[model samples]
Target: MSTPPRLTFVNRQGERHARKLSLFGLRALIEEMQCQGVTARAVLSGTGVLSKDFDDDASLITRDQRLAIYRNAQRLAKRSDVALLAGARQRISDFGIYGYALASSRTLGDALDLSFRHLRQAGPVLQITSRVEDGVIKLRSHDPESLGDLLPFVAEFWRSSNLTFLSRVLERPFPSLRMLLPYPAPPHWRAYGRTFNCPIEFEAEAMEWHFAESIWQLPLPNANPAAAKVCQRFCEQVLSEQPQGSELTDSIRAALVNRPGRFARIDDIAAHLGMSLRTLNRRLASEGLSYQSIIDDVRKTLAVEYLERTTLSVEHICERVGFSDPSNFRKAFKKWTGRSPSDFRDADLR
Candidate 1:
């Protein structure tokens, strides 16, 4: 495989600005606080997270309060335990904010482009970026810190974010995807298995999702074509709310991949990622995949692309894709593309 591009994270103009004073995993934060000895009952009572109108499930703590909670947690714990809360959900959603803004889009790609443009709002702790190489778009994270203990939480968050966005916006099952992580296996593998309906990898440098680039033009749910204007307006507003950026996801992806050797067991990956095996498993389950599946899917996607685009022989391709036996590669290829390697290549050449 070609050396992956060093996806450098750069800043973008703050297109739209608004406030995102707190959102996402508020309940979890509250629950975590209980363990920390700050047991206020609701967002309004114990913390400034909730207002009288904050009873709705959709409401979250304000961005300032969110940061405050993290700061408070750090103070209480006498360490920097609340780093995750440094960024706002509005910014994180900036990655997908365009989708919500669009009344309806033509393809997932169009929506994703918006996501790519705005992912910085989530914070600089983790940044998600993608590059289209050899007909496959590889999405990797940029994180400076190792998220070993937080792998499960991070994995589940990605899975949940992907599922909720795709299901709501596209109104269809996401075509099979590939996930890669550097952490090892977790206990709740089966749960992840069902959600993504694809492979997961622990201890991987990047988590890649493979789909036809053409899918970018697919139409969104709402039939109205005029929605673009509204979507664009909201995009600006979302950016305005959160002027800062994040790269935590990016760091996490990098930490997972830049490991010492080839794929390690989930336990090993988790340890490397600084997360417990169970947490990794449980988080992946929430996303409907496991660490192993992510690795398999990435290999699977690359294998086909290599076969289609290169003159390499079957054995060469197999080796490049980490397959030990030609026969096993053939079997797996058949399952993936429904044709023998020779036939598949010939068809492509034709």
Candidate 2:
């Protein structure tokens, strides 16, 4: 994997330096408060974003702009527990294409993988690293202290949103066994206790949480790996198609997504795009991606959708995804989702 860009600040003459969040993050919080009768201008007053940008799907705003919105939300809330309130109400659907991936994960583990894999979908300044050891599933966030005193609200809003999303996906309240944070308890932090329903370790090494092994194993009713992969590709395409994205990448993705169950080879795609195979390979390599990776991603996606959403046998699904052999497809599916096709289809979500 490529190294993530560093968060560097070189202040010459005290010029401001702040993080940048996607319009997705800004709209998520603002829309929640708007539903509660808060106006966009009221929340984004000093953010320098016009009334027009609030509804623009392609807008990007600075971290200071987001902090201003949060501060206004706190002011309008008039409560110390504003984070919990906002977190409780912030639906994962607020994330657009990303939410579809989370909703269709086969297990909490799958969902976490998708979230961590595309952490930038929430914002550029966020990272959530997760791992499993000794029956404990842990998540450590690099987004802990980016906002100074606004960290508390940011922390709660982030944590509660994840917890709520996890619970909703599993169709059960799956609270953490323990949560770790470096911040001290504020005056009205009871909302934290009420929201998490577990031990909240203050002043810890990092912002982390522990999920019981049982919780991670819980099956999700909407566990369609194929659909989740499609959503993942769509999210990546949208990002790569952004100002920072290459038009070449977007065209490649468009060609791939427009055809389901037809995993096109790089040669075919390149020809379709009216370019030499070597040129197609070079362009995608410039973006640090391989045509094979793209094809495999689509194959994994199609396989899972077939397994979960169709009565077609595994062999049929394998052929549909372009696998010539049943055995080969089974191994690939297991590698993609960490579950065999039979086990995935037979497992009961309840």
Scored by TM-score, the top model is: 2
Listed in order, each prediction's TM-score against the native is 0.48, 0.58
Worst 10 residues of 1 by lDDT: 83-92
Tell me the tens digit of each residue's lDDT in model 1 across 290-349. 666656654564566556545668998787666789999899889877998999888978
Regions of candidate 2 where Cα sits further than 4 Å from its true position: 1-20, 25-28, 31-38, 50-58, 124-127, 143-146, 242-350
Residue pairs whose backbone atoms clash in candidate 2: 226-301
**Model 1 residue 292 lDDT score:** 63
**Tens-digit lDDT track of model 2 for 239-317:** 5653333556545544554444566778888887789999988888888999877667657755655565456788877
Clashes of each: 75, 1
Positional deviation of residue 137's Cα in model 2 after best superposition, in angstroms = 2.4
Model 1, residue 311: distance off in Å is 46
